[model samples]
Target: MNHPPLAGHPADTGLELCEGSALQERGLAVSFDIQLWDHPARAFALRFDGRPVAYVNRCAHVPAEMDWQPDHFLDDSGEWIMCAIHGAIYDPRDGRCAGGPCPGGKLIEVKVDERDGKVYWYPSADVQPAFPD
Candidate 1:
């Protein structure tokens, strides 16, 4: 599983995730691998309300992957992020729990920025790019 480094994107601009056009409003997400707390993990980015958002794919309630289908995180209505397993819903804007088993819980968000027709995710202390910089 070798992933080529994102070409042309400097570290200061963050790691490129996908093309901005790849994410449609409430459409399929663009999934990516990450290193969460030094462990391999999955994350995804999608568009909602005309903006891009991302999160570590783990559910707030059970720490399980939440997409109902691969790259599908939004509920049927395309309004909220629904956990595939336990029905936990989260606001796409800020990853805050909107309803379900995990009251007051929130998704672990991956900071993202969209510019120059591309989407980029920023790594934090707990989250890092899966590939070496």
Candidate 2:
């Protein structure tokens, strides 16, 4: 698969966090629940076997973040990412809705790629491409 070029962006976004990797080798899941855009949009970064994966935190059914707390979006089992508001479960591998209110509903995928071993989001990491009132 093709990934984006990581040029200039913060070390962390709502979607992911740097796990103290100078080369950005690893990424820890982060909660964007704090920064709720008008659209409740949040970006995340994930690294699987050194591959970069970035996606928005918004669910497909309703406009909400997939986190119960800051950087605590994963379930207690740490198996799948979950939405505390509606009990939705998502596969971290593909962001596909595996369970919950909308069984088939999936989280929106945000575009991001890795460059020089670091992850990055497009239009910037704030996810505030359009300011909300």
Candidate 3:
């Protein structure tokens, strides 16, 4: 249940994810390891509309990884997050299920913030850092 220390930010600040420049607009996501309810899992962060968005890599339709290729979440149009397994499309801005299977479902969102040239993802009660500080 331990978390990393926020060196320059507040004690409630999120864990350091990556450099701000690492996420390109509508491009490959920056993947990272996490512990979801004490189980190992993966999460990803990407830039859309000049802002950062993140979500657990699991699709809502099924507890399966959604990326077609490593770090490749967005579809060919680069407008939505598409699951390679069930073909569920999600809005990257909010992780809402937009089309295909799993209607009315939503991806597990991972809160994120960008500041001081870095991106950080918040750890929740259920989601935690894989490697504690």
Candidate 4:
């Protein structure tokens, strides 16, 4: 697969994820694609108490995507992030496993920032933006 060039260098620049209002309108959760360890990976962002939070899309219990549907991460009450596959609940603020099968396990966190009307997620040494094949 061909991937697009990363928005910016992970060390210096932040990748623009989405508009702040758009996330807010969508109950504060949205999905985006990135490169993790040189492989295609999915991630999601959420707003917890008006703050932006993000995590790798994979579940800690089992290395599987957690969203119930495309970009859907929150439960009905929109209070916690739930894994659609195993009923695992996670704390949106810190990606901690609040209650679920993956005890003492937490979702991988991706650094994110919401500023100037847009949301930006940062890549670390292990995670980077995916490029076209």
lDDT of each: 0.89, 0.56, 0.91, 0.82
- Residue pairs with colliding backbones in model 3 are none
Per-residue lDDT over 29-125 for candidate 3, one digit per residue giving the tens place of the 0 to 100 score: 9999998877899999999999999999999999999999999999999999999997999999899999999799999999999999999999877
Q: Write the per-residue lDDT of candidate 2 for residues 1-133, one digit (tens) a residue.
A: 2224334533244223334242232335633322333344566655544555556767666876656765456677666777878888887677788888767776665555555444445443334343335
Query: Model 4 compared with the native: what TM-score?
Result: 0.87
Best first by lDDT, ranked: 3, 1, 4, 2
Candidate number achieving the greatest lDDT relative to the actual structure: 3
lDDT of 4 by residue, 1-133 (tens): 4334445565466888888887773284788887777788988888778778889998899989998878888999887789999999988878889997978889999999888999999987657776656
lDDT of 1 by residue, 1-133 (tens): 4334545554467988899999999999999999887788999999999888999999989989999999999998988999989899999999999999989899999999899999999877667788654
The C-alpha RMSD in Å for every predicted model, in order, reads: 4.4, 7.6, 3.1, 3.5
Among these predictions, the greatest TM-score belongs to 3
Candidate 4, residue 100: the lDDT equals 79
Task: Score residue 66 of candidate 4 by CA lDDT.
Answer: 92
Sorted on TM-score, best first, the list reads 3, 1, 4, 2
Candidate 4 RMSD computed on C-alpha atoms after optimal superposition onto the true structure: 3.5
Candidate that beats the other on lDDT, 3 or 4, i.e. the better one: 3
The collision pairs in model 4 are: 1-133, 2-132, 2-133, 3-131, 3-132, 3-133
